[model samples]
Target: MNITSHHGDDQVRIALTGELDMATTEQLRAHLDHTLISRPRLVLVDLDGVTFCDSTGISALVAARTAAAAAGSHLQVVNAHGITAKTMQITGVLEFLTTPPGH
Candidate 1:
Protein backbone atom coordinates (compact mmCIF):
# COMPACT_ATOMS: atom_id res chain seq x y z
CA MET A 1 0.00 0.00 0.00
CA ASN A 2 1.03 3.61 -0.56
CA ILE A 3 0.15 6.41 1.86
CA THR A 4 0.18 10.12 1.20
CA SER A 5 -0.24 12.55 4.08
CA HIS A 6 -1.20 16.20 4.22
CA HIS A 7 -1.38 18.31 7.33
CA GLY A 8 -3.25 21.54 7.90
CA ASP A 9 -3.00 23.20 11.26
CA ASP A 10 -4.17 20.57 13.74
CA GLN A 11 -5.56 18.11 11.26
CA VAL A 12 -3.90 15.48 9.12
CA ARG A 13 -5.40 13.77 6.11
CA ILE A 14 -3.96 10.49 4.93
CA ALA A 15 -4.77 9.05 1.55
CA LEU A 16 -4.27 5.33 1.16
CA THR A 17 -4.02 3.32 -2.03
CA GLY A 18 -3.49 -0.33 -2.92
CA GLU A 19 -4.00 -3.28 -0.62
CA LEU A 20 -3.66 -3.14 3.13
CA ASP A 21 -2.78 -6.56 4.48
CA MET A 22 -0.17 -8.26 6.63
CA ALA A 23 2.58 -7.09 4.33
CA THR A 24 1.57 -3.44 4.54
CA THR A 25 0.16 -3.17 8.05
CA GLU A 26 3.49 -2.43 9.64
CA GLN A 27 4.18 0.39 7.27
CA LEU A 28 0.85 1.96 8.10
CA ARG A 29 1.43 1.53 11.81
CA ALA A 30 4.82 3.21 11.61
CA HIS A 31 3.45 6.11 9.67
CA LEU A 32 0.58 6.55 12.08
CA ASP A 33 2.94 6.45 15.03
CA HIS A 34 4.90 9.32 13.58
CA THR A 35 1.84 11.30 12.72
CA LEU A 36 0.31 10.89 16.16
CA ILE A 37 3.34 12.51 17.69
CA SER A 38 2.23 15.76 16.14
CA ARG A 39 -0.88 15.59 18.35
CA PRO A 40 -3.23 16.50 15.58
CA ARG A 41 -6.76 17.49 16.48
CA LEU A 42 -8.13 15.27 13.79
CA VAL A 43 -6.81 12.50 11.57
CA LEU A 44 -8.80 11.74 8.47
CA VAL A 45 -7.95 8.56 6.61
CA ASP A 46 -9.15 8.62 3.04
CA LEU A 47 -9.62 5.09 1.81
CA ASP A 48 -10.99 6.01 -1.61
CA GLY A 49 -8.05 4.40 -3.38
CA VAL A 50 -7.69 1.36 -1.17
CA THR A 51 -8.62 -1.59 -3.32
CA PHE A 52 -8.38 -4.26 -0.63
CA CYS A 53 -8.10 -4.81 3.09
CA ASP A 54 -7.70 -7.87 5.27
CA SER A 55 -8.06 -8.51 9.00
CA THR A 56 -4.57 -7.20 9.53
CA GLY A 57 -5.57 -3.94 7.94
CA ILE A 58 -8.60 -3.72 10.18
CA SER A 59 -6.38 -4.24 13.18
CA ALA A 60 -4.10 -1.49 11.98
CA LEU A 61 -7.05 0.86 11.69
CA VAL A 62 -8.21 0.01 15.17
CA ALA A 63 -4.73 0.57 16.47
CA ALA A 64 -4.68 3.95 14.82
CA ARG A 65 -7.89 4.88 16.58
CA THR A 66 -6.38 3.90 19.89
CA ALA A 67 -3.24 5.85 19.14
CA ALA A 68 -5.19 8.90 18.14
CA ALA A 69 -7.27 8.74 21.29
CA ALA A 70 -4.21 8.44 23.45
CA ALA A 71 -2.78 11.45 21.71
CA GLY A 72 -5.96 13.41 22.46
CA SER A 73 -7.07 13.39 18.86
CA HIS A 74 -9.83 11.82 16.79
CA LEU A 75 -9.63 9.57 13.73
CA GLN A 76 -12.18 9.50 10.97
CA VAL A 77 -12.29 7.21 7.95
CA VAL A 78 -13.71 8.34 4.64
CA ASN A 79 -14.53 6.85 1.23
CA ALA A 80 -14.66 3.28 2.43
CA HIS A 81 -16.57 1.39 -0.21
CA GLY A 82 -17.73 -2.13 -1.04
CA ILE A 83 -16.20 -4.89 1.04
CA THR A 84 -14.11 -2.51 3.02
CA ALA A 85 -17.17 -0.76 4.40
CA LYS A 86 -19.01 -4.04 4.84
CA THR A 87 -16.18 -5.59 6.78
CA MET A 88 -15.92 -2.61 9.02
CA GLN A 89 -19.65 -2.58 9.62
CA ILE A 90 -19.82 -6.28 10.35
CA THR A 91 -16.87 -6.08 12.67
CA GLY A 92 -18.56 -3.24 14.63
CA VAL A 93 -15.47 -1.08 14.22
CA LEU A 94 -17.32 1.31 11.96
CA GLU A 95 -18.99 2.93 14.95
CA PHE A 96 -15.68 4.35 15.96
CA LEU A 97 -14.38 5.39 12.58
CA THR A 98 -17.48 6.72 10.96
CA THR A 99 -17.81 10.47 10.43
CA PRO A 100 -21.55 10.61 11.06
CA PRO A 101 -24.05 11.11 8.22
CA GLY A 102 -23.46 14.62 6.94
CA HIS A 103 -19.84 14.96 8.00
Candidate 2:
Protein backbone atom coordinates (compact mmCIF):
# COMPACT_ATOMS: atom_id res chain seq x y z
CA MET A 1 0.00 0.00 0.00
CA ASN A 2 0.94 3.62 -0.51
CA ILE A 3 0.07 6.44 1.85
CA THR A 4 0.21 10.11 0.92
CA SER A 5 -0.47 12.78 3.46
CA HIS A 6 -1.50 16.42 3.36
CA HIS A 7 -1.91 18.85 6.18
CA GLY A 8 -3.95 22.03 6.61
CA ASP A 9 -4.43 24.02 9.74
CA ASP A 10 -4.95 21.41 12.47
CA GLN A 11 -6.12 18.65 10.20
CA VAL A 12 -4.26 15.93 8.35
CA ARG A 13 -5.65 14.05 5.40
CA ILE A 14 -4.15 10.72 4.43
CA ALA A 15 -4.85 9.10 1.10
CA LEU A 16 -4.37 5.35 1.03
CA THR A 17 -4.04 3.30 -2.12
CA GLY A 18 -3.51 -0.35 -2.92
CA GLU A 19 -4.07 -3.23 -0.57
CA LEU A 20 -3.84 -3.04 3.18
CA ASP A 21 -3.08 -6.39 4.70
CA MET A 22 -0.65 -7.98 7.13
CA ALA A 23 2.35 -6.89 5.12
CA THR A 24 1.23 -3.29 4.84
CA THR A 25 -0.32 -2.72 8.24
CA GLU A 26 2.93 -1.83 9.91
CA GLN A 27 3.73 0.76 7.32
CA LEU A 28 0.35 2.38 7.78
CA ARG A 29 0.74 2.39 11.55
CA ALA A 30 4.11 4.04 11.26
CA HIS A 31 2.66 6.74 9.05
CA LEU A 32 -0.11 7.35 11.53
CA ASP A 33 2.40 7.67 14.32
CA HIS A 34 4.36 10.25 12.41
CA THR A 35 1.24 12.23 11.54
CA LEU A 36 0.00 12.21 15.13
CA ILE A 37 3.16 13.91 16.29
CA SER A 38 1.78 17.10 14.78
CA ARG A 39 -1.20 16.78 17.12
CA PRO A 40 -3.77 17.41 14.47
CA ARG A 41 -7.29 18.43 15.48
CA LEU A 42 -8.61 15.84 13.06
CA VAL A 43 -7.26 13.00 10.94
CA LEU A 44 -9.10 12.04 7.80
CA VAL A 45 -8.21 8.81 6.06
CA ASP A 46 -9.30 8.73 2.44
CA LEU A 47 -9.80 5.13 1.44
CA ASP A 48 -11.30 5.63 -1.99
CA GLY A 49 -8.15 4.31 -3.59
CA VAL A 50 -7.71 1.35 -1.34
CA THR A 51 -8.57 -1.78 -3.27
CA PHE A 52 -8.46 -4.29 -0.47
CA CYS A 53 -8.27 -4.51 3.30
CA ASP A 54 -7.86 -7.50 5.55
CA SER A 55 -8.36 -7.88 9.26
CA THR A 56 -4.93 -6.52 9.97
CA GLY A 57 -5.85 -3.31 8.20
CA ILE A 58 -9.00 -3.06 10.24
CA SER A 59 -7.01 -3.46 13.43
CA ALA A 60 -4.67 -0.70 12.39
CA LEU A 61 -7.56 1.59 11.68
CA VAL A 62 -9.05 0.86 15.08
CA ALA A 63 -5.73 1.56 16.69
CA ALA A 64 -5.50 4.87 14.87
CA ARG A 65 -8.95 5.80 16.06
CA THR A 66 -8.02 4.99 19.64
CA ALA A 67 -4.87 7.03 19.39
CA ALA A 68 -6.73 9.99 17.97
CA ALA A 69 -9.31 9.84 20.72
CA ALA A 70 -6.65 9.66 23.36
CA ALA A 71 -5.02 12.73 21.85
CA GLY A 72 -8.29 14.62 21.98
CA SER A 73 -8.62 14.57 18.22
CA HIS A 74 -11.12 13.05 15.84
CA LEU A 75 -10.50 10.38 13.21
CA GLN A 76 -12.63 9.81 10.13
CA VAL A 77 -12.64 7.46 7.15
CA VAL A 78 -13.73 8.95 3.84
CA ASN A 79 -14.76 7.84 0.37
CA ALA A 80 -14.94 4.17 1.19
CA HIS A 81 -16.98 2.08 -1.24
CA GLY A 82 -17.77 -1.51 -2.20
CA ILE A 83 -16.27 -4.25 -0.08
CA THR A 84 -14.36 -1.86 2.08
CA ALA A 85 -17.57 -0.12 3.08
CA LYS A 86 -19.29 -3.44 3.61
CA THR A 87 -16.49 -4.78 5.76
CA MET A 88 -16.48 -1.67 7.90
CA GLN A 89 -20.20 -2.02 8.43
CA ILE A 90 -20.06 -5.74 9.15
CA THR A 91 -17.26 -5.22 11.61
CA GLY A 92 -18.96 -2.27 13.32
CA VAL A 93 -15.88 -0.06 13.03
CA LEU A 94 -17.59 2.28 10.59
CA GLU A 95 -19.68 3.61 13.44
CA PHE A 96 -16.56 5.14 14.89
CA LEU A 97 -14.69 6.23 11.79
CA THR A 98 -17.24 7.30 9.21
CA THR A 99 -17.06 10.81 7.80
CA PRO A 100 -20.17 12.92 7.93
CA PRO A 101 -22.11 13.76 4.83
CA GLY A 102 -20.61 16.64 2.81
CA HIS A 103 -17.17 16.05 4.20
lDDT of the candidates, in the order given: 0.88, 0.88
Task: In model 1, state the lDDT of residue 95.
Answer: 72
lDDT string for model 2 (17-100, tens) is 999889999999999988888788989999999998888999999999889878877788898888888888899987677864
User: Candidate 2: lDDT of 33?
Assistant: 89
Would you list the clashing residue pairs of candidate 1? none
For candidate 1, the clash count comes to 0
Q: What lDDT does model 2 reach?
A: 0.88
TM-scores for all candidates?
0.92, 0.92
